[model samples]
Target: MSDALNVEGIIEFFEKNARHPLTPEEIARHLGVGRRDKKRLLAHLDELVERGILVQLKGRRYALPRKVNLVTGTISMHRDGYGFVSTGEPEGKDIFIPARFAREAMHGDQVLVRAERGIRSDKPEGRIVRVVQRAHQTLVGRFEQTRKFAYLVPSDPRLGQDIVIPRNARGKARSGQIVVARIDSFPSKNRNPEGTIIEVLGDPGDPEVEVLTIIHQHGLPHRFPGEVLAAAEEIPGEVLPEEFSGREDLRDLLTVTIDGETAKDFDDAVAVRDEGQGRIRLWVSIADVGHYVTEGGIIDREAYVRGTSVYFPGRCIPMLPEHLSNGICSLNPDVERLVMTAEMLFDAEGVRLESRFYPAVIRSRARLTYTQVRAMIELGDTEEISRQGEVYPALQVMKTLAERLQERRRLRGSLDFDLPEAEIVLDLQGNIEDIVRGERYFAHRLVEEFMLAANEAVAGFLSAREIPLLYRVHEPPSAEKLQQFQEFLSHFNLKLSLRQGQVAPRDLQQLLDQVAGRPEERMINQVMLRGMKQACYSPENVGHFGLAAHDYCHFTSPIRRYPDLVVHRILRGALGKKGLSEHEKQRLAQTLPEIGEQTSARERRAMEAERDIVALKKCQFMVQHQGESFAGIISGVQAFGLFVELKEFFLEGLLRVSSLGDDFYHFEEERHRLVGEHGRRVFQIGDEIQVRVEHVDVERRQIDFVLEGAPPAAAQGDVADDGDS
Candidate 1:
């Protein structure tokens, strides 16, 4: 028998046969396994059973889980006590597990689910049959005490159960303090999980403690390991002369970096030149992080674990130690830094004529902030232009090329949501001073266009060489989501055209353009965004649906993103004009899939942590403004309430339906609105209304609002339009 007759072969045999459960002897006989391989075959069967891939039935028979109406996946618990199990298949729909059927599976736990009938055929329900792996060995929560014993209320509501902490296990933790607890016993159907306080963070309301809570709750790595730090310390702080031996010397290219004013780690620098006849040559140089952190080394291993840097309001948990992320690999101005450069030539219509990548050494001419670049380019400020000195001419060329590239993308049907992002301002003491819409000028878009061009160019380049690398893929929306979106647009007298049961990016872009300057513009944009699929890292290239590009990957910020660093390594191999060797390709092919999944999960964790901390800050800021009235727009409508976004502070709060004291109301699911039965009042998304800040719950990160005036009466079952008021 061949060595291939292992786990994979066993699964293949089961899949192909699709017969009744078979015993180990029967299965081995079917595969023609020899006597020497019998022990290995038995071990493989046991491993599959443990992984929930194969279920060992009664009488020592084995069958695929699906054959027994069982699905294996990670369970994601909702705050309302129910959970959903994701099968991790591209076309698989989540199986809903009701609160009663959830059993003991908590959020993120991999479990075996027994399929059950549900009301909707499209949505299947299931019950947890077994927990294959526990997601949380420890949890962060608020400490609480009673007369006899203490317990922890998990900061993450999805946990669904409080962990009981025995008196002896409480340690120095006091009531109302944030603490980390290690689970001593997992939750069961009849009892909650038991844990001991491992570390007490601090009082909940403290700014530092609030941030720390989110960090621990999400399991983010905040500090570098000593070995990783020592490895980083071993690297030189400056680029040596011999380091540029085999690299192109672009030190005199008048290159400049454009970033936020507060940015310390500059990863990308750009230089542009007009080559006459509406032709432009652009160079995008990114920090050569892979050159320093070799693969599978101490630093590389830690960076792989971190996946990506996590940024909060005033702090960041960097992927690499500061010595590398902020020093030699940073590409700081006036210092010679090693970089992987993407050089391309583009014509007037923003069509890429030619592109190439190479290792290079560059001395940055200047570091420019987005605000300054905007002033110089958009406002044509003389002082700002003069202040840039030697790089002024290059900035002008950069602006022209960026505009052409942006227009090309717009013409090609790229979706630009342009949604407002909250920029949290902090005082000297780290307390939130204000929350406002972040400024996004054309200058920001200018850099974005360049980065997109380089990313696509590099992806296309490496893909042509047949190298395996991670691609930033954004698949199209599903047909069901498109139908729901079309229904929503119909309520606003709008329509989304679908081609062959699929809506194209251009169709959505057209709809966006039609709704510009209208009252429902923001609401429609948000809904359309929700309908689209999330972009993730994958070894297989599905193309980026939102960008409307055939090839796309993240290649600009290798310092912060692991996927970018991976791409850089592949690009470097191809730079020698000889792509990766057979051994290297085989290794990557075997590992890239798992790497993609791990990095994507870590990315989501970082995003969730960032969102939680920002919401906490917003709630804290709103505490002082309780009971004050503000103009707002109904951003979301659900059965229980309407979520209103305040105009002044950009904070969102719920206006519960029960608070509509004038009349009884019912939710119109299709219309996405709440309608009063007797008064004929309406509360729908995009409707401008006045709301008073009734309450703010910092612990739960919630804000509650009440109507400022009596509910406005409208025609029966009619949506309030912009002209209605």
Candidate 2:
């Protein structure tokens, strides 16, 4: 009897239940013994069943069957009524929920599940008993209307289900426009769930429509509530004496803001000078937004949830109201602003010599744009220049320091891509007027390199002191990804083997220097970039492999990113009679993973939205000059076709497989190449191919093309009419 209850377990079958059956092998696993030890434990478990102390289900799987309380999990419903209860943990497999037992739970709803004794699989099965939490209170999508009802096709790919709207609940859904909807009736046995369209966005093709749709889809608030805006407006413009007294007076530090001419919200400024002995002193002054927005205050909570300011193509969705982001907290020239400053001394080698971060009040002496600085520094004493009287000398000194820093960084492992960046000039109606490539001059490089140095210096200082703070980390690529990349390089007879960890950043930079001015430079660098993971803020400081920095953080741009703001607050606390609570410190450690996830996700969304808009504009540009011949490179190849990007406009389009004549073409996945079956003709990615525009599908955002000087074995009728596709 004692042996029967030997195993530590939750279930204890009574003698009446044991009358059913048992197998020693089944009872071993059931009794919580290791599978490897099942043979010995199995003998004991079988004796328990023989002694009438345990029961076995069919298939000889032993269990002490009882009416146990159920555990709760999220119900992942399907288009059909049937669903499964999925636990939050990664290891837990989902429990099946049959239609009869799955009450009215919709997709993404947390629900109570009762484990029932029934036919079972590898894991337990359950029936949904009660609803707990609903994932989304509102949804954004394009609406489709009929005479009797309306439906919303969700904008988010993860949503997975269309929302049905009754005629009375349609509210204001237009046939083909985006709208936000609130779910009303959940799906039941006889009827589809109903929703009310709460908002109506504009047409799909418009750029504004795209940005707003994305913001709505993510449930990110684009505009502040009236009360919040009012609260922000009431904040006083003047700085208190108490605020100015505790800060370092960097007002006469010759600090200058170097940003784009169009930028109104200046968040960071740069100041650098030769400290002699082949050393340089660099200081990055970030606008102290945290001082104006206090902890647990209205603006602070809003910024915390928003986390970071989102910059759309033409506009920005400021985390704080404009009164602070663009006005009081902005680092305007000749105006005193609170700041969190990082000052570092570096030898000519660009390595920071023990840095210090402190709270300061600084006056930005000049607001210089990249255009003006580039012209003044490079083409000194020219038209539209030489207006600077007070700060011109200091700008020159700063420019020299930046050049030294750049030289040192290049000698190290920094991968200076210097890729062409596209910028759109929009008309008053928000239509694209011109697409310009932003130039990278010494002045721009100076600010960037200095800010990077300052950020790293501050991060290193905190780490050396063993302070827990958010750090920006970038690890080396996975071995699998690196191997594939190495294979890609072997095609050009270029071999790079990373020793153990990341290959030296300097080695990668040397490879870049070798490939510069070559035809394959763009393709090679782009692929190399794709192999590296994005850098993000976290409490765990795994050194950045790309920048080759041992420690890094976002101490600049407090106006844009929340972590920077947090750093600013910490600096304030260190200088004042205060420190963060243990709760806040613990909260920082706990929330790092979640913060990393959301920030990374949102950053991708922003990039995707930008890419989509640019591609659409490129397609539109192609539409205007459809018949014109252009030289392009084969950017991608698949079984169906080849994707070509034009050299003239940097636009991309697909050359359909049918355009390659009657030959059947198959894509070689391993080699990244496409081969023609009949003629044995081959086309590879990164090959230069000229193509003419054949068709454009604006609705699907796809462009079609036909190869130039190639015989059409199969005449192209439609974009998808590619043979062997």
Candidate 3:
């Protein structure tokens, strides 16, 4: 009777009595609903039924959906026409939908599915009953014109169907031109989707057009709205004297910002001092973005929608307007800026002794690059040190403190995967000049340690006081995934010990240490990463598994990440003597869950868009090197073929199994290899070989490779499985 009017209360009632379907009258009686609240109870039940959370049986009886072999989730489509529906639960298995049973549901669509099992099948399959919501109302594709009619070919392969365009719907879109089409009608069992061309971009192969294609494909907001821009213009460009009231004045602190050479927005600056007896005092100052972008304002709403900034090869789509992100909120050198500072003291063991947060103002002494810091501190460059002047001593102290922190983290079994990243060099026309491996410097790690410490300190400070805020949580991997990973390791004659069918971070770290310099090191690292769960934002604290931190949150880059801004706002509210009022706490309790989910989805979207553009660029760069041979390693293996990564450049290509002309190869699923039945030749992951670039498809962002001496085989046979890379 406590929450009788709430939807959760109704769901809880059904869950407890799952085996018995109850009518509305019986449900009301069981929940002890009063006559005055009877209508409210009925409304909650109706809403639940509408959302597929509950199903109605004969005689007007209602029950939980899962109790009747039904599941609700989003469907992910395969390029080959099949699809899978994720149950949206942490430990739920995906329901496989074969091509014929896929119906008209498209990728990312929320749908209600009826679960079933096929003969001799070990896994469950599903048939979509109804689609609750469509993921895409408009999509980016290429328009094709025939003699009689026109259609649009979707840029994303998972779309799996072309869109028919009526004669009158083609608005100035020519043949072979990229366009954005709004779907007027969705697909049926026998017909394709119908659409109208709303916007026509330029032809394909153009640099700007390609970039726009990726942006539109991901539904990213590239340009600021007019209202948001106008709101940003109202804010002052410099810190005013009156704006510094009730703020600590740290303008004379020996602070400096370390970032890459091309960085424009400096969000965090650090200063370190060595106290006696191996004690250190650190100050991490972040730009006070909340000061300008108030809650529910136009600019704040736009930032919330964008969630985070998207960075491409040579461009960036910022969350906020340049007037704010690049002007007032940025910690430019020798300029007074408003900031929220995290001050902490650590003892000899790198354990934090005390910490506090406060609003402050600071004037950065210098804006140094990572390369310069590395030269001054690690390389001991005389000229670089002389050029740094007074900042050199601070850099030295920062280096020492960072080493201590790194050692402490390592002892706690933090997993660090030192994977290579590609740095694409673009010329004036945005054409690739060269592709090289990005260098990792000690200076980068030093700044990283300081930021991590600050983030942890802030999270601990707020969580200890019972504040409700978004947390950055990374949950542990599932037992099934770990078992598969263990099976894969058995091939290399390695074993991962598990206790009670569970794996700890230390177990994975030790495995990595065992394979430190072996040939299979990179492959094992990648596989381990894939097996782990992705990190996301949540209002509930579950502790970060990867960083080995019991408490963690994003607090460094508020200008780019919305979660950080949310944290800053919450921290400010708690800094007051009264803390958050009861009403304020209730409001946040109702809103933070949705905020966390939305921000997490937006972060994933940005990451996918960035990766898509990079893959396209890599494909474009390989176009000039056709028929060239390069030394490579077998990075992945599947039933379809071998994925080879080149040593000369950070690029991967697929060598189809059919291309092996000398023998018929059989796939070994458990061992991750392909073996020739007649020749007895085998190819497995981590094997070194030479490969020739056979083809490059820029539009699909795909590359094909062939054995160096093998004759060109017929068109690749039907792909039996998905290939990696």
Candidate 1, backbone clash total? 0
Error of 3 at 466 (Å): 1.5
How do the residues 689-722 of candidate 3 rate in per-residue lDDT, one tens digit apiece?
Answer: 9998988988778998999997765444566646
lDDT tens per residue, model 2, 673-705: 789788888888668877777777653457778
RMSD of each: 3.8, 9.8, 2.2
What is the TM-score of each predicted model, taking all chains together? Answer: 0.95, 0.77, 0.95
Error of 3 at 165 (Å): 1.2
Q: In angstroms, what RMSD does candidate 1 have relative to the true structure?
A: 3.8
Q: List the residue pairs that clash in candidate 2.
A: 413-505, 413-506, 661-713
lDDT of 2 at 70: 52
Between 1 and 3, whose lDDT is larger? 3
Candidate closer to the true structure by lDDT (higher is better), 2 or 3: 3
**Clash count for each candidate, listed in order shown:** 0, 3, 0
Instruction: State in Å the error of residue 48, model 2.
Output: 33
